[model samples]
Target: MFQSTAPQRRSIPHGRRRAALWAAVVPLLVAAPIALTGEAQAATPGTSVSYATTCTPGVVPAIHGTTISEITVDNATPKVGDTVNVTYDVTQPASGNPTSTALPANVILPTGVVSLGGAQTGTVTVSGTRTNPPVPGNAPFPAFQMTGSFVVSNPGAITLSPGNYNINSNYIISLDTPCTIDTPPAGVSNTITASPATVPNNRVITDSPSSGPAGTKVAISGSGFTAGATVTVAGFSGTTATSDVTQATADASGNLTATLTVNAAATTGIIAFEGATYTPATASPPVAYSVTAVVPPGGSSQTLNSSVKGGTLSMTQAGSTVTMTPVDFGTGGSSTGALNAITVKDFRGGSSGWSLTASNTNFTGPGGSSLPAAGLSWTPSCTTTAGSPSTCAAGSAGAVGTAGATLASAPAATLTGGQFAAGANLSLTVPAFTAPGSYSSTLTLTLA
Candidate 1:
């Protein structure tokens, strides 16, 4: 009877609702077993998963919070002309054995970011391990760690768009977990210089009195010369003349002057002036002057008689002597004979008066000597055929007079003829009472 009452009309919808609930609950229950199993599996020691990932294309990965770090390059973000670098590290948890392995790193660039040239790239590895092994082998427990890295170079960041760029590196690491990456700040550098040479001034030299008489003054002039400049002249003969004779300092205007007396005996030669050192044919050319010495004419001396007979008389009987002497006409006249008169005799005709004449009155001598008579003569009449008064002709003898009457005492004379008698007769004779007055004559003497 109790069982029959139990069936007291339960609603089908409630049963259905219960059934759906059971269904849902049963699956949850089933899933619980699997979840627990998985959790247990995860909790077991030595559980691990491969750690590696490709880096963003064309970008370099940065490092953070870990001791070990590394970078690598791969195809993930690969671009025809792009390069990238990545770094990885670990944080917390230590590992007994640490190892680093290569990981995929990639580089990529926008069409305009990279040029057609090949991209520059590099790679690196990082690793760290705990000092002690965990327990001994069963399975070496790894310290908390991380791996893999990527390097990427974005051409967009290059100085010029579509220009080649470089990817620094990629990295892989062990013994460090939860690693982060950071990009290092970029570095820049640069350099500079200068240019040129030197400059100089011009020089000039001049000389005065381009030409003059020997022993003349010569002045050396220099213009546009340097200060403390040295000057020289060549072709100098005496001590007064020298190869480097003159020297001077330039004035404010770079002008200089030097005065010197040229040697009177100097021969014609080139006069050269120069700087500290001889510079032949320089702008300041050397100057020279033609010099000449004046020479005077030589002189001679002669003697003549005061009187003689006839138009001409024998030089032998003229009672006149001649001597030769050398003289320097340049200086005025000079004589070396004592004053005296020579005598001449004429044997001409009646009580007629006769005149005596001589030629060349002045004479000079280094020593006393009788001068030569140019001529001796006497005129028969006071007047000559030409109606002119008779006069002694050159190199001729003239009138005769009484001996001693026309003669004067001879002073001491040193004859170049060696010597003469102390009382040598220097007398002439004429007709008695012939005109009576004294007649004068000239004589000339020459010496070697």
Candidate 2:
């Protein structure tokens, strides 16, 4: 050791000097965190901070590094009066963590401001729980996710900044953690663009019955109106409208129903009706109704007559019932008989004449025994009492089978209308083994 100093110098105490140095730096350190949060008052819209500090115990609390919180909105473009949701997440740092674990950590967030056009009006209230996992004694603080909501009152670019929050330790005590946002880095913030409010379309439900006479009561109904508001009903003729001034209140479901009387002096034309309100300045869609002029008192009866003219080619029979002369076969042989005269009057007025056909069902007798309709044969004779250019010809001789035969027919160029009479000579053959009994069959005559 070289002891070359001529005078001995007094040394200052290391503990006192260190204490003085710490006293100066400690105040600056405390004030630095506060200044960062206080910048929120003069912060630009949409700017947020990345660091935060806990003020729990109102005294010494852990100050965390950056990567503190992130805010997100459910709707970025919300219309006026629309409710929007916000989420604030408290992220854990990479290294720092508490030594002890607090079970069931419930985060209670604070209320923030909604800034629009540089003027803050609406408030956002955040709340919810975010618990930590059951780790051992040494464990990092768990992340927290808090939620909140606010209604968009005005339209424009809007900004949101999260406020201070607290942790409810074990559901027993509250711990304040003020994580106020400061001047933000570029493009890091919670921002949204609000759109103008939209209006609903007017709905006019019904006006019953398409047409009605004047002074008639018409039921009108509509929907989509202010609740418990009076509506004015009116009738519009062309561009001019006459108000019925019928007062009707809207129900809880925003539906309105009212009765409107057509004007007594209304003309016979199409008219429109509407239900309207003034407070919100809304009107329902126009419902069209046809209004008929009122008829005079004694004008009910009007003499009317119609000329009855024959339309289609048709025929009518004179008699209701007829009986053919019966022929008996003594020992089961063929017998011939004359058929009753069939008189038909054709009142058809067209040159296209018609043909008359005849058919017969099987003759069923006692004990369900039957004879085939083909067992009978006929020779038809027809005559028409019509004018010239109209002629009726008798059908060809053939067996009267179930399929029927043409009894009489007039050609297309024949008479337009006439009285026609037909007669047939029928011959029936019976087998020797046939039972002896009387049988009847239905003979159908069709004119087409």
Candidate 3:
């Protein structure tokens, strides 16, 4: 470095300095545009911090000539297990070229509903022409159309809200069968009636019997009697007698008959006939009949005679004497005398055993004269000294006596008459009887 004494430099003014700096920086600033262009070319458009924006109409633009119309789903009534066809039509919008747009893929169905196969989702083409014509040259927008169907397994009315929903939405479509829980027809009733109106008394009618005989043929005639009708007979004591009777279907006349046989030994009582109609109709009233048994030969009559007068005889034997007495036995006593008795003949005369003797017994007057105490005796045989022959002897002579007698040390004997209402119990007691077997005698109780 040469050290030289420079003349005192005059200070440069600020404005002149600034002008000189600008003159030098002018070319650099001028080259900035070229550098920015190069950098811009190296980077992608998206990386830029600044961008431009514009607004477009929210609604789809209208197409000329082609029109857009709102779509509607009509309410439908469907039967169970039946399919219903639903149709929706779209009209293209005017003022803009119609473009092909696919319909939404899914539609919500009501609860308890299922869609039939096929026709689900996608675009369908609808051709249309521009009225005013597109602004020269550009291709006309394509139009779209679509169709679908569904079925209702249950019957009902379903409403759809105006909005998008997932599958199986708010309400469901259903079909109901006739007569089911939901669907029912109007005006139906049931009734039942008997045929012939009245059954004959004492006649063996098929179902109605007054007194059924063992082989009696009865005809039970009634209305509402059909092939499946059941018939039964009930007795007065609630005893039920069943029979597999013949059943006839009603013709145009609405009458039927069933034949039945009455059982033998059935009590004489009321006969009741009952019938039941199934499923389709109600049952009928039970018919009844009064019955009686046929009379047999020699059977006692139910009537009584006013003029008959009854009398009775009682007898007892003591030691060697037999006594008889007369008394009133009433109506029952007279009936007892009517019974027949079998006599046992004695091959060996026995005077000691027992006896009914005519000579020993005596009758008083009128009513007593008819008493049967004669020509009967029970005697024992006596041994002869030679033992060659045996002799039989009557042990007692007769005397009038009371109906009962007793021995000093004999077991008590009881004689009881058959059961009788009122009056007296016909009884006898005998004393000193020497028989181990039963000894009985028949006496005539007179009905004067």
Candidate 4:
């Protein structure tokens, strides 16, 4: 019912709060969309409206309002059917009044809402509890202020849950004057828009190998965390290796991975905490872990190597050079030139047998011109192509020893190793008619 004392508006009979506000003396039976009207024409400028604790001065009059404010349920995202407190009001002193003032205000809401006060305005619906403006002058109410909420009612096919709501609190204040009633504005209302609501997702933590031995490396991972956020991974030990922590950062994808090394002394019943931040407001689910004193079969790995030492053999020539003194048949009978002692080393690991051979065995002149094989002999007795013995033959019956062996294509003698040094005595018995015009030969020794 309309009263002369105050112009009160009610929630659309059975509807949801939308972005628009609607008001009518009688319930609007039609569900047609309400044509939006602009801001109310300036109220004479002689009267101003201010919601601040202290009104701003030195300015023209204007109407500023909050068209859309959030309404949540138990701190969660706002859903249809949720209870909420919605407040709104207009402030203007009622000191000067010609006859009376009639300013109609209404709350329009979306279509799908249920529960909470909702009424049928010509079109839209809305929901929210408001702090209504106190009666104009008397009842201890905020001057020219108003507030209230509407119930989201579902009448028939109308849904009070989710939709683009046209919730507006519109008003047109009229002042009656004896001379002439002041011409007021067309429409004054709060217009606002809001993004759709959604539910919050839960966070999660996981690991590669859930259980392992102390000192084993494990990969810790997390998901569904805030983007570009920092989280700490803590290791809580039941006994021995006690407390430890590390931090990881989430990428734009809201995921992160960190590696943790189990303490060698860590015991069972270990836990890891992936905190939202250094000092988090919310505690994520704790990640449980286990550590064993003995490393599991494949937990740790060891590498071994097998090696062997090689053998080396070496031979050193007395001086790496051999020089022969001139031997002349002019004073022929016997001429012996002493050569450097050749040394052989048995280094085949542990004393092995070896042999040595000399090339050209016999001293020869420039072009294949040779010397008598019998004429040259060595101090050691060995076999050769020439007569095995010369003038120094085995004379004694039981003694099998000759003075020396002859040097043919090869030395009538061979050298034995296992000895450091063995002397090479060259004996040359020159024949009386032997022609000699400075004879020289190259002797090469190969050892193995």
Candidate 5:
């Protein structure tokens, strides 16, 4: 048996002395036992003592709370090298009492985003922790606070893209989406975002020949807009009357061309024009379109010698109205006399034809006495030339006789292709017994 010395010194061999030291150290070492999670020692002789002293954290938290309350960003759509502020909310586990870890939340980085420089941490709020279950207690210490910022490396590419990232490294969450955190205490969701985004410089409009008279057809065109969109072209009529005259569908390349009919009565001035998309409609600034009044080509006139050959008459147009000299019959002259020759020249762009007609077949004068229809005659046939054509034989005086009846001139005057000419000859017979001081009759030549 080995004995220990009590304040005693003795001479012994070196090998024996070494054995004695070993014997003493062995009992003390055996007396102190190292437990997996507690301290163990012999306190009083044979009385054993054991209690928890320090905690050894395992690889993971004991009770991992899966709920992530929120994740906020300073700039959701950041350009390359643009610092983005981020914040997260998550409940930390209770410490010392047996719960989870106290690491603050973290914001995951999106692809193509490289951290450059920014505030790496934000103020953190921790839920009160308890070590005594349902009893008053305090949280022992703080776990590592997890916070940081990510900056964009390629700004041009990163902008206008969704923030698709996570709130922590352990979860595959999205900043733009409500993420479901799947940990022990599951069924918790997280959300994140900052600003909205859109593309720019995508539309234009133009019109050809911006100014014109009423009824002019204008061509409207556009490009650089959303493809496959329906565009409506409206012409400004007044402050309130915006008439939409044409509609076009955009092609895949975002181009369109259409024609619009300007109202014949549209007000003259700067006419506003606009092109717009129907779906999620947007409009280009109103462009000015000039409207002008139509100017007359100017009036023309012509005169003709009366059938009396000696007398004459003339025709003229004032504005849109036409006037002609009155036919005159001399007092008691020849038993039979001719009236006059009327002619017409057409210069209308429509190139339409016209006809002439007489209101009555005879003449009436002072005493209400009238001349016989047979006394009145005319050559209805006309031609593009100033004189009658060869086919106008029946047009001779007394040739086309509807005895005692009315006569309407025919063989329409026309602007054949471009222009036309026509003439008319009238004849009358005077009864010797026509009791009158001066004779007069109304002859209306309606030229249309």
Candidate 6:
């Protein structure tokens, strides 16, 4: 069985608190699509609208014209159930009486249609301060931008058209100013595509030979991890506190493979293997492995001495002692070479495991000028011989300094006694200020 955790909501930026308040209101208006009315009259700088206002509760509302432009959606890629900010530019034409003033505004957004079929509706709330001239004059209101937040209810194309916007006022008394839009500006509405929500922490980890004796080799695999991320494989005994852990890097396909052997000290119990990232935010379902103890022969109450023959364990390389391309850094500060295919044969029958390591000497130039051994780095890789049951793994990439580095390895249980082919992309770095001359270095590979 698999379990999933809830995804956390995205945090909004500071100073955009108005959008947050509208998020709570947009979801409630997701019923049938609301149809808009009226036809295009005369096109304005933005969207033209006729405004009817009342500065006093008992007085008749005044009339004016305004345009709304610069409609924008903050999120380029919105997802269903996500809260996004939609902003608009409004410019009021000179008109309201000497005591009229604009107040906080609220608007219903145009119905949105999902590409996959379905309609979504929402609203916007303007929370910015609404006080500027005309408290008593004939000047046009300054152009300003208003922003509101809305929850994306569906996936697909969402077009925001001109809608009913209400502007309140406080001119010695509370008043309401309702505005009606006649038509939307040509190609002025912003369209945003909302995608389907993604599943959170979805991953699967599995292993072969789930039930085995101590020293049994198991091949473990994981998928749905972040690409190029390191994945940790952990094992815990069901009946004991004993545990083990190993790591492998996920490939471009977000898949990982590793080999682990049941610990020798492990007692008969279930060994659960789980895969997770470095942060370990989430883990895949445990792949249970049963451990069975090896039984000894029983006899009639008598003591007997017995000896078991140990098998041979060793590594042998085919062809030359080492296979590397000759490097010629012709007038160069840096260059690269390749470590040709060099197969290492591990005939160690049921042995714990083996590691192939490499180190290098400093490149010696004419007259003995030298480049640091650390300048030589490599991206190591390895593959099991064809038809081989062995699962060979490449070690992490690193420089081949005097201290050396593991180039490749195979876990104890992963190999049924076979050959491992190893190679690497070699890079050589030389200081720019170094004297121009031919340099040479020796690389040594060892199996342990």
**lDDT for every model?**
0.25, 0.50, 0.23, 0.32, 0.32, 0.49
With candidate 5 superimposed using the best TM-score fit, by how many Å does residue 373's alpha carbon deviate from the native?
Answer: 99
Clashing pairs in 2: 390-415
Q: Tell me the spans in candidate 3 whose CA falls farther than 4 Å from its real position.
A: 1-209, 227-239, 242-254, 267-283, 300-448
lDDT assessment of candidate 5: 0.32
Question: How many clashes in each structure?
Answer: 66, 1, 44, 55, 5, 3
lDDT of 5 by residue, 273-378 (tens): 1243222124433344666666667955443322211111112211221122233244333332232334443332111223333432223345444443334444
Per residue, candidate 4 scores C-alpha lDDT tens digits across 1-448 of 0001112111211111111211101111111111111000000011122221211111222212222112222111123343222222223321221112332222111111212222222222333332333233212112222223343223322111211222222224322111110222112232212223322334556665756766677687777667777666555432223444567787798887887776745433222223522221222333446664464676885434333322322334344333344445555455545434444333222212233433222233543333432244445322222332211121111100111121211111121113344345554555544455444433333333
Per-residue lDDT of candidate 2, residues 1-448 (tens digit): 0011122111111100010111000000000000000000000123444544433334345554444566766556567786666666656422223335344433332333322232234556676554455434335456666666678877887766555555433334454444433333212357777777855334344676545666778787767666776666655443334443365777888788887777634321222122332221254434456665556887764434334343333344333233333434344555455555666554533334567776554455566445555666689999888563457789999776545688787765423556778777776666655655655555556655
- Residue pairs clashing, model 5: 79-155, 80-155, 81-152, 202-224, 307-340
Model 3: per-residue Cα lDDT over 251-311, one tens digit each: 4544456554545453222222224321112223233333345567888545332331211
- TM-score-wise, the better of 3 and 4 is 4
Identify the leading candidate in terms of TM-score: 6
Candidate 1 TM-score versus the reference: 0.21
Off by over 4 Å in 6: 1-66, 93-95, 98-119, 134-136, 183-188, 201-208, 211-448
Give lDDT: candidate 4, residue 110.
Answer: 17
Clashing pairs in 6: 98-136, 217-413, 352-412
Give the higher-lDDT candidate: 2 or 5: 2
Q: Against the hidden true structure, what lDDT does model 4 obtain?
A: 0.32
TM-score of the candidate numbered 3? 0.19
